[model samples]
Target chain A: MSRLRNRTKFMNKFFKSAIVGLVIIAVLIFLHFIGWLGPVEGLAVRIFSPLQQGTRAVSGQGKSFYDSWLKKKDLLAENSQLREQLKSNQIDVSRIKALQEENELLKKELGFASESQLKHVAAKIISGVADPYSQTVVINRGQHEGLLKGMAVVTENGVLVGKLTEVGDGFSKVLLLTDNKSKVAATVQNSDRTAGLVEGQFGLSFSMTNIARNQQIKEGDTIVTSGLEGQIPKNLLIARVESVKEVESEIFKTAILKPIVSFADLSYVLVIIP
Target chain B: MWYKYILWSIVIILAAAGQVFLSSSQNAIMANFDLLLIILVLLVNLSSFERVIWFLVLSGVIMDIYSSLPFGIFMVSYLLTAIILEALFKNFFTNRSFYSLLIIGSIGVLVYNLFFLSFSGLIYYLGGSEYFTNWRYLGAIGWQLVNVVIFLALAFLFINYLSKRFKPVFLHS
Candidate 1:
């Protein structure tokens, strides 16, 4: 009988506590919806930013060390490949520089805006994929760095990464191009310059879809931003075509893209201030 | 005691920090590790319902601050998970043994994923956002299940073999 009474008392306390918890959560949701939680969130972000940044720095170092130790053989092969690619790229750079000057002169003559210059802000990635449903990375720079929503983020080598979705005082969240919600107007850098919409597939890979069957897109084609979206600039490298899927009945064809940069191992990303 | 509350608060904060650390590593394998969820599930089995509730709310709040999803998703998922865990502990898997802990932890992971996925789907359905339902997500849950079980088993071994500080204490209703 005493045990039964103790059980009843415990049950009462449990119900009361759960009810209180539900109310607190509901109130928080309401405050967030009404935009009253921004200041509080900003304060929290400020407090946590330093800690997250420090942690990320340490973790990145540790991960790289461990990865190198584990994949020494693979690293050796990759290093040689990169060295060869670097030599070829150096040649291409010189060629592109001349073309860039000629293009600028043409733009001046035609009264078109030159796309050669862009503002770049370096930021460290503090966190990646805060939740399962989204593919985002939080960077250390935010409003303090003049970052705003829809600003393009990229890798150091000028590969398109993502765009800022949420900008706080101290940190900003970049919605990666691999997120299902992310879609970029992309063009195949082939002779035909075929255009399509590059969409993220389950945060794992990317696909260039909505390509008209008549357009001549093939494997090994480079995909780059089309600058159709005002925020993201043109000619930023996105991915490469891995395979093209064609169907007789479907009006459009899709191509699987292989991302040049691994989204999971990103340590630093540059935010374009354009 | 007041001191206990403060200590647990610190623990919850550290758990949140651990989540940030794990997410920052950028390793695909580490990405599926849910530190906060595992902590909540473990706390539910080891502590009182009220204490678990306290930790749940704190964890939810901290996670929500980092998440881009609408507020209350973490809170709701964590709350419902706590309730389910508490109920499972009290009514179903009542043994204070390794087997019971494994069962409870597995169920907790599954329940939390179910709630989180469903809420996310609902949000997307209502035009709040977009999320892809893919086979990889199911595979991620499978990995989490394996991870939690391995973690609990190792923890159980460490407690039973190495230390008595965190021995399993059965909760009483």
Candidate 2:
């Protein structure tokens, strides 16, 4: 009889629980269908949310009471991280652009490095300090690399830019061909092979003098180093002949030569060291 | 009798609102703390089943009204949490020290949150909401857990303190 009562009690409990569970489920389903949660929460929040704030205020410091939800610091941290990432990305982009420019410069320099007889040291143009009186540039290589005074400073395209005048342990200075005191022995690259002494005029242009009035120099004639008798090498590019002028009273004709390379854009340079 | 129930209900509602306020004001990468759950865990553990069961129901309904979850979702989760806890905490704990209360509250918040989040997700799936919030599982859960630890400590301390110093005569001595 007790066993029967136990079974009966068990059934009764099961049925009751099942019924309660079903009722709960049905109510939840109806509420969900009606979408009443939003309004209810809104009203509750409008009425009671302040109490939560009050609770926080009373619990401790403004910080202690707000507890885990003072997430401004977290957001600030995330903002900082993202900002750092963006900064790094920007740096990488600029680095890529610089590398591309260097690659192009190196590709142009490859032939000069290989075809030249003299050993070459690549140096970056640290600065171009040209005044009205002289045009000079500082390079990153110096006497430590066996760079001596009077070594030819040329661009990647074999254009003779300057001659090294002074050297230090870590840097050297180059006197550009455009400097007033600069002098170079050059020959016009025509069939006539007219030779002349080129000298700088006002740190701007070079005047090639001592060419005979009858020399076969013309417009756009290429001028190169005569390699006559100095530490300078032959075939070093100087400039192109812009115009040849002749005066009846003068013994030799003059040609105004325009430099093939621009000084403002010079970055990478090769020092031709003997 | 039921007047105390009304007072407790008011307290629970206010606490829920304060949590909501804090969550809204704070800018975060989805790091909202479950303050309501922490408060409920304290209440459930401290109050008797007969007296607090109705309060739990009212609190759940209030939370459901306040929450973005479906109407019955928080209601159901709160009810289930109270029921489960009412049975589980019966005579199991006597120590009400600061550390003991904090540890117990942490475990309670963890369990309640798991249930709440799971039930809400189930309801969301049933509701056919197209937005699948996978982000909530990763960083949000971690931050929420941290929140649970910190908030539980505070909630347990505050409620435990009040329950100690300000006991009415009708309450257990």
Top model number, DockQ: 1
Per-prediction DockQ, in order? 0.25, 0.05
Candidate 1 residue-wise lDDT, B17-75, digit = tens = 67756754566677678898888878887887778877877878778878867667888
Alpha carbon lDDT of each predicted model:
0.81, 0.65
Clashing pairs in 2: A40-B65, A41-B65, A41-B66, A49-B17, A52-B18, A53-B18
Considering summed lDDT, which 10 consecutive residues are worst modelled in model 2 chain B?
A: B22-31
Look at candidate 1 and tell me the lDDT of residue A40.
Answer: 78
- TM-score versus the correct structure, for each prediction: 0.74, 0.36
Candidate 2 on A106-181: residue-level lDDT in tens? Answer: 7766567777677889987543321112366556677669988788889987899888865644666688787766
TM-score attained by model 2? 0.36
Query: Quick one: best lDDT, which candidate?
Result: 1
Instruction: State in Å the error of residue A87, model 1.
Output: 20
Alpha-carbon RMSD of each model: 16.2, 35.4
User: With candidate 1 superimposed using the best TM-score fit, by how many Å does residue A4's alpha carbon deviate from the native?
Assistant: 5.1
DockQ of 2: 0.05
